[model samples]
Target chain A: MSEKSPEELYAERVKRVLDVAALRVPDRVPVFGPYQLYPYTFAGVSFKDAMNDYALAREACHKFQDYFQPDLDFGPILAYPAPAMEMLDIKWFRWAGHGLGDHVMYQYIESENMTADEYDEFLYDPSHFMMSKWLPRSFPPLAGLAGWPAVRTFMWFGWTGGYVGLAAPEVQEALRNAAAAGEELGRWFDSIGQYADETKAKGNPQAYAGFDWPPFDIIGDTLRGTREILADMRRRPDKLHDALEIATKIFVEYGSGAAGAELPLCWIWMHKGTRNFMSDAQFGEFYWPYLRKGMLALIDQGIIPVVYCEADVESRLEHFADVPPGKVIYHVSTTDMVKAKSVLGGIATIAGNVPNVMLLSGTPDDVREYCKNLIDTVGKGGGFIMDAAVMLDEAKPENLKAMIDFTKEYGVYQ
Target chain B: MKEQLVSAIADMREEEALQLAQQMLDAGEDPQAVLDAGKEAMTVVGDRYEDGEYFLPELIIAGDMLKAIGDMVKPMLQAQASQTEPLGKIVLGTVAGDIHDLGKDVVGFMLDISNFEVHDLGVDVPPEKFIQAIQEVNPEVVGLSGFLTLAFDQMRVTIEAIKEAGLRDSVKIMIGGAIMDDSAAQYIGADAYGPDATAAVKLAKSWTGGK
Candidate 1:
């Protein structure tokens, strides 16, 4: 018999993932390897070099896939373009070779990019707010955009005067810097795109086609900052609701548009809305409605929404039952897998719960034992994916190998 | 009035809490009483937090209320010259190479409200800095905080440095973060691991024999 081609393998892996998403039993439970800088570490490549050199980053990612061979490939997506971010002077992230040591992973710096009183302005004209206010605050190189006239002003005779702002020397410089950054981003995307194609050709499917955040997180994480947004819930609940409403629509469009049929998954990193961050009532009121709406919208577009619950979301599992059966996957971090399976068992696909600390600090035997238990319980029938509780940055190499190899071996269906 | 103040703060009535605090000071109430009431309200907030009724937002706003009330009464309390001794001194920091500090800050705030003098060394604190702070402050308890996986080694290294400096036995060490647990605490050679700020306060209080 002729051996299966890479295309066939790719199709098989994709089907395995989608089968779990649709709550059907697959040939075996798929294992997802979600690591940010582990590949660089494993390949003996410095994060600084990878972020600066796209080719080296791609090599490191390919090397990692060649070794682990998990069903889904992460590619070099987390190896952010440090030079482009530097040129733009983006304040949201501090990457390697910039503010952090060359070996360190990038860390997000959160602050209130938008003040409390600006909700009205943001709600009224988000584009102007982003260009004139948010962008300038987030990226210092774009500070000149603050002086540019509102886009709405460019009507009939206003268009002639509106073009005047573009002629400003600082604004011109900002445009040049932005264009240069865009070109840098284009190069980075091209490299990542090539890596994805190569990995697909090698029989590995990429995890997510696009990424998104819940509207509440978009406000809490990027706009008002976590503390400020939470306070806003008490101080200005009405305005917060209005802002979330706007964000929901914007995110749905952004999420669906970015994802394609080639890989029909939109990854949403849920930062807040956990039990420690808010009450179940608060989550229901401020967080869940819009998130459910966004997920349903993405599903309407035939894209599966993969929500990575970052923190302990055990108490909030019941709320996820609202999603359409077999349409969404909850990649939980600190949630109890037993409870998750019972609650979301046939309702939605569940993945993860392996303690990252175990992978980092435990022995290979410990990792293997834990994986066996997870496979026995969470991976009982079907509709579950094996993964670390959180993205791995530092881990014991032997332990990671044990997790992947053990899960693949013992997670077979009868 | 004190019950009103407590309930106002505990219920997260930020504006009303501040107004009530200001009103009490204007009425010439003993500054210590207002401070005591703020502490009492914080305990209620902490209890709710432990019970999972209140979360980060409630804790933050409660801390803010206490700070405002402290500001209002500090000068007056100083003029009276009747400040009580703090329960204990605790050195705290988010360990080296990890800059995430939301959890650390919350722990610091809770410790401060719990009446421990917290010497927060801020984020990305190296082992040498921790040893230096340990020597300088001579704190009763040291809390190491980090939210990332890399922090495990850093925490172990920091504890080792503390031991090398001959200060390990002098202080009861505790580790706290989202990723921390008893096993990690054991691995890092800490006396205990607190999952949240409340747990940190409890550990500190137990170590110092404070009520």
Candidate 2:
């Protein structure tokens, strides 16, 4: 080969990673994850201990991160405080350390000021607010950031949901405030931005990278729940619309000016359960405008807007058909890989849909075989990345290791 | 920096609401007349949400204007209700270990519009108060809300508490929130799951149907 420049060499190494993304050749599928939380039992540590002791928290996260060696690095910006976990301290919100009770964790709080009439408005709160009080109260997120300075930080910017059924007056305000609070979060992010590049390059540079954060998830979570929001769309249409409007604006601003190249992307936790609740018109009316506007703006910012969407987006792929190639990555959750690959064509990247249940419970051989088959299937068209449908809270550590080993060995073109 | 109420109900022309309320009242409008007019305006806004024309801001403004009118007519509604059964008693709060209240607030407003007497317990409620509230207010229904995955357990505990206390038949419990699914409602022994504010209103209405 002719003498290659340093940029070209770096590109070559990255190509191995991007190749799976490009679907250029059979490549190692990286174990990228979405919405994965720690199981309270793993490492025999509880959520309370992890929240209180940096070492404990770091240890638990590192055990998995090291075992997985996830394709992307740990993002540091996320190291900051969580709002809901602190604001809603009923009983389990405490950090007592050890046992089943200690593993409980929560990040979103109920709204205290809203009434049922304003349910939708509360839902629109920009998914962040009153988080500072909890950040320092429990684990000291700023302190946690200091531990792993190499990973790139990504925040749960916002959630996308349909207003289906409805809720009680008090519950509506609490949920709506979940989104409306995102604007106040700008100040917190401003605090974290101060450390964006200040991290000294440790062995784990992945932990220090800063991503353009989207503030949308305050209302919806893929692994959690949205049945209520979906219901509200149908029962209390007016209020649902009201809340979704504000939720949409905050994220649009987040994906646009506020993000400013923190790698303009959104991680929408679109889980299973109510996929059929809304008609396409409803999807367009309720979900598309905000997603289109926010994602489009992020793309305009020169950063590819990847959507870490869950479930089979294949059926509704047309909803996102307008997104240009390399501009989006919809990580599959419930669909078959090979089929999703064919449907997605070559336009965008497919991050994952690997079932954690199987991997966590299967043998090493089984893990290798399953991944190999998936790589062979979806990896065929290029633009594929191997990952779990979502993060496994209780996935066996050994099986996780097996998945990584298999990917590294067989996922390469060479 | 912002009129919380005005911003909350951005969809209504506050300017119009102000005029409509005054106009309807000036033309020999009683307090009930003004309240009825305000509620009618909100109904239009609610219809828009159902039709998919208006969104949350409009609903909020409608609610905001209604609240403004309610402020003017609270004594009247209260006076009428004192002679009759209270409009409807509602027991509401975020489940224990969960502190988000936005959803509850919206539910609170919807309750008012639908004419249910609301008793808000605030967030981070334990199972005992849910039981205690049921004993005290003897409300027609109880609402349990949790916005985080970490708080689903609270729903379960409270529902069980209501059941264990043998209050399941006396007070119907409704559960709704972002992290909650139908399974949680069933697990918590709730009578129903009002996934949104409107559905919750329907459930609340249906609960008090015969009473």
Candidate 3:
């Protein structure tokens, strides 16, 4: 047989993943590169350099792709622009060289960015609330935004006085800071886009186009925080439900809008709805309804929702069975993959069960054995994508090579 | 009243639990009795967590209720000049280069309520800081918490530092976090690994010779 071109290889790879997504047995199980900071580490790039230098980040990503050659390319999206974060003075995360060691990956610092009693205000006008409340509290450079008038008041005659708020010197300075940070972000996105195009040209398609969060996580992770939002579940159940309802609409729109026609997949990282985060009953009440709604909305847009279950979600597997067949992908961490296959197989694509700890600490033979077991079970008869349980950062090179190479060789379907 | 307080806390009626505790104290009840009821309620919460009836949210709210009630009754208890000793002393902190505190704080709260004097060194604690805390606190048990993969090395490094300081034998160390398991525990040279805060409390209880 003649050697296939990159275009042929790319088309075949995309078909393999899409076929698996639709519950058909593809040529072989797709192996996603379980990388977040691992590429930088593999390429000998410091976390500080990766975050600050977009070109270096792109090089690191390319290095990983050329070496490992996984079916899907892990893009440079996780390498956030340190310059933009510095300009915005964001409090949500502390990246390397800013608030951490030069080699340390960025860590999210969760706090109560929104108060409990302000749910009504947030539900009333999320745009205004974000501008006047959330943004100011999260971004110190945007503290002047707190002085701005309600965004809704900027219409008609209200514009005369509303424009006065924007004229304030601090607000102007805030606008300048925002503009500068936005420009830096645009450069970062350009760097990522360039990497995506380059990888695609080399027959390696990116896994997902963009990312979103469940409505409950949007409130819990970014707005009210893990502790505060969980407290709100008991303190003000009604208000919490109302806020989730509002957040559901916003996220559905945001998620569907982020997907492109070429790669219609939106990644949603499920954080607070895991097994130990809440009771199953609480998940039913506050989490599943809206998460299902968001997933269905994206499905309606012909976009696939790749839900990454962060912790053991064995208890919540039944809740996921409600989704449409073959339209969602559940990439899980600590979830029982055999049970996940039994519950979600043929209904939705199931991916991941490889332990991150094993990859980081175990031997290559251990990784091969684990992957062989997973292929025999979860990867049986297709509809499974092989990936690590979590986003890998510091993994042994031999173990990672074992996971990828073993999955590709052993995951063939008859 | 004590039964009502316990049920209120266990049932997650935060306002009622706080109000009921204040009412009991106002009625000239023993502050220790009120504190004991709070502890009993936490025991219920911990049991529910073990049975999977409760989770992090319940633990947090229950912890907050106990802390609030304790804040209210502590001064009064001090006035009476009667205080019981803690079960044991524990030095706890999230190891170096990791800032994740939700799990660490949950473990700390569980340890605190279980009657361990927890000298919480907070997040991103270096090896030297752990050594300093161990020397100052002289705890019977030490807990090292880390949520990221990078923490495995840090935990090992911190344990080595403790060993270098010649305090390794003085304290029994147990590590807990999301990514931790028995293998990690062995790799980090800790005495044990607790999967959750409840298990952590159990480990502390077993090590300190407390029920």
Candidate 4:
């Protein structure tokens, strides 16, 4: 595909919008990625090659939008210190997104079960180590071929969260130490946020939450680990309330960097660990309230929250059924798309219900039928955006083209 | 039947209006009459949900009323009457190795209003507990929920226990939550599957018919 010059394209000034209190026309359906395989692959660039020199990725994004015409453009070169730049004790502690198990990184675990005032053990601290370079490893062997479907799976893997600020254990002792770590994490954001704003990271100053929480990798580390904290809400309700109140307060203070008021942006949030499969009572009695409060604080701070209700959220809808529309967007899964559209349609802009499996496994006819049905069924009013239930991996290039072609032919209302 | 009892249930203070429903039932008011009253409220809530009028908070309140009234009304009837009661009985809980329970709470709410007698066993329930509950309570259906991969193993143990206890045929079983699929239902030997609370209630009734 040939390219379009900056002057040739219609300008819909895009920037990361942190305020989520209101809504407006986003230049187009925002395209995002944990891996921008479509761009990198076209450039004859491996994720590894792009790591060597990232600007080479610009053409790939332009070409993809030229071909696929996504409203939002994404870049996969999320910066990290190169692999050997720091004392990354990868051999000892594999990085698992500081606390909430995000991804792979310098995982030098300084101590184990340090919950009982046991800092005497080796303490894992990023302050002690130099910045480790984050180099992208190879794509799957099948990927990067001319026609291979570009599927970039970054939901759980592409993570690098560590002692940016004090994690769960250090939150108690050295309160000052935790603050220092947080400040350091904030300072590190200068470059990351820059790349985030780079025309490539889908940087739209007018965008939302720096493209949905700067990758859950970074947010999960900062927001508070969900497993123990949310579980505590049930085991000890009052204490959980107190902890959640404090955590919510902290979330407002720290999480303000993510989204904004005018236009809410959200990740298609996914994780094997914390999905919507928990019992309804548990979602109600324990987690939803805490999450509701955190979101309330964010909305109060003038941010609109688009929750990509991951997995089967059919059981949890009652809790969020009251969330006001124009402030919420739900990226739905295939498990209960009909009910989701029925129950959540008026309150949240329906973002998706496309079948991820069908795109890869189905033929052009099957893909066309499914996507057309999705658009017709989910796209009844104007609030719908065409997208997959989850991320699109290296899909059959032809299938991806089929989707793009269909959207172009059928998406316009004029 | 009066409408105030239905309003009270929607208000989640079933205890306050329990007498109204009892009065209706005692007056030779058909069980269908009492059910209609509750369902009227639930229907509004369910419609509100479909129309995006009601949220989880309202649903929870509606469910609370149903459970409270259900508990109050059951003792009034004889044991044999209990078997032929308003929807069939369901034993619901979260799976093992996972302590989360909110989804189960909503499922309980959905089942109760759909007219099932839901015996909530709470979260982190092991396989044997499910087996014992099925035997002692003799529910017509068992609804199992799991959100964790590790808990899938427990879901298996639960179905096996049902089969092992020779109670599988007597009771149709259902499974739900974040990670489970129809295949999982087949793998765990579930008779039915619910992707969400609304669908769960509907699926559960399809098997037992609120008998």
lDDT of 2 by residue, B1-211 (tens): 1122223333455655565555555565566656555555555555555554654434544665666766756654534622324467899999886666767877776676566889999887888988898899999989888765445556777887788899888988898775444555665567888756777878887878832
Candidate 1 has an interface RMSD (Å) of: 1.3
What residue pairs are clashing in model 1?
none
How do these models rank on lDDT, best leading? 1, 3, 2, 4
Per-residue lDDT tens digits of candidate 3, residues A191-272? 9889989998888888776689999999998899999989888888999999999989988888876555566778898889
lDDT tens readout by residue for model 4, A1-414: 126444233233233111111233332333322322344554455544443233444445445555665544444434232332222222223322322122222222222111212111112321121111111111112111212111222235422232322233323333443344455445445434454455433323223353333122121222223333333332344644444454455445555655543334434343311333334555565456656666666666656556655565666666666675656655655546667667766666555655544444446777678667765675555455666655443455676667666765665443
**Which whole-number lDDT from 0 to 100 does residue A222 have in model 2?**
19
Q: Write the per-residue lDDT of candidate 1 for residues B1-211, one digit (tens) a residue.
A: 9899999999999899889989998998987888888888988888888788888878878877888888888888756645568899999999888889899999998888788999999999999999999999999999999988888889999999999999999999999877677888888899999878889999999999998
TM-score of each: 0.97, 0.57, 0.96, 0.48
Candidate 4 lDDT (Cα, 0 to 1): 0.52
| Native interface contacts kept by each candidate, as a fraction | 0.60, 0.02, 0.69, 0.06
Task: Provide the lDDT at B177 for model 4.
Answer: 69
Model no. 1, DockQ: 0.69
After superposing candidate 4 on the true structure, give the runs of residues whose Cα lies further than 4 Å from its correct spot.
A1-10, A13-66, A77-208, A211-231, A258-277, B1-211
- lDDT measured at residue A91 in model 1 versus the true structure, 0 to 100: 90
Clashes of 1: 0
In model 3, the Cα lDDT at residue A172 comes to 88
